[model samples]
Target: MAWALLLLGGLFEVGFTTCLRFVDGFRNVPWTIGFLVSVTLSMGLLEVASRSIPMGTAYAVWGGIGALGTVLVGIWWFGEPGTPVRILLILALVACIAGLKLTAGH
Candidate 1:
């Protein structure tokens, strides 16, 4: 349950970041609101999930998910480059995230 919450929180982190890209320095009201809401939910979920999970492990996993998701969103939604090297690095990051989960013991 804690891991689930943490993963969900990480997804919210990606939401907030993607919203931020459209926020236009907070001048865009709707996107700004989206960013705020997502950030709130992400942090709240992270806090709750950290109750049972080790803080270090939880934070790393959350951050990894956020980074991975954001990068994918960038490529898919923003037409960002998806070069082979970049994809390989992203895959390595995924492996590292999995390794952390496997070793976290929770």
Candidate 2:
């Protein structure tokens, strides 16, 4: 349950970023509202999950998910360039996140 909440929080992080991107430096009222809501929800979920998950692992996983999802969305939705090196680095980040999860247990 905690991990699931953490993942949701991370996706909200991506939501926040994506909303922010559409806000034009927060000048757009609706997108700004979306960004604020997403930020609040993401932090709230992270706080809830941190109660059970180790703080370091939870934070790393949350941030990693947000970063990975945001980059992919940028490439797919916004036509951001997905250069070879960028793709490789994103894969490396995925490996690192997986490693963190695998090592989380005693």
Candidate 3:
């Protein structure tokens, strides 16, 4: 349950970041509201999940998920470069994130 919540929180992190791009320096009201809502939910879920998962492990996993998801979003939605090296590094990050989860003992 905690892991699930953590994952959700991480996804919300991605949501907030994606919304930020649409926020247009806080001038866009709808996207700004989305950002606020997402950030609130993300932090709330993280706080709840941290109660069961080790703080360090939880934070790293959360951050890793957010970073990975954001990068994919950038490539797919924002037309960011998807170079071979970038993909390789992303795969490496995925491996590291999985390693952390495997060793978390949760």
Off by over 4 Å in 2: none
- RMSD (CA, Å), candidate 2 to true, equals 1.2
Clashes of each: 0, 0, 0
Instruction: Go through the candidates in order and give each one's C-alpha lDDT.
Output: 0.96, 0.94, 0.95
Q: Which has the better TM-score: candidate 2, or candidate 3?
A: 3
Give TM per candidate: 0.97, 0.93, 0.96
On the 0 to 100 scale, the lDDT of residue 53 in model 3 is: 90
What is the C-alpha lDDT profile of model 3 across 1-106, one tens digit per residue?
Answer: 9999999999999999999999999999999999999999999999999998999999999999999999999999999999999999999999998998899885
**Cα lDDT tens digits for candidate 2, 1-106:** 9989999999999999999888998899999999999999999999999898888998999999999999999999999999999999999999988988888773
lDDT leaderboard ranking: 1, 3, 2
Q: Enumerate residue pairs that collide in model 2.
A: none
Quote model 1's TM-score.
Answer: 0.97
Query: Taking the tens digit of each residue's C-alpha lDDT, what string does model 1 give over 67-92?
Result: 99999999999999999998999999
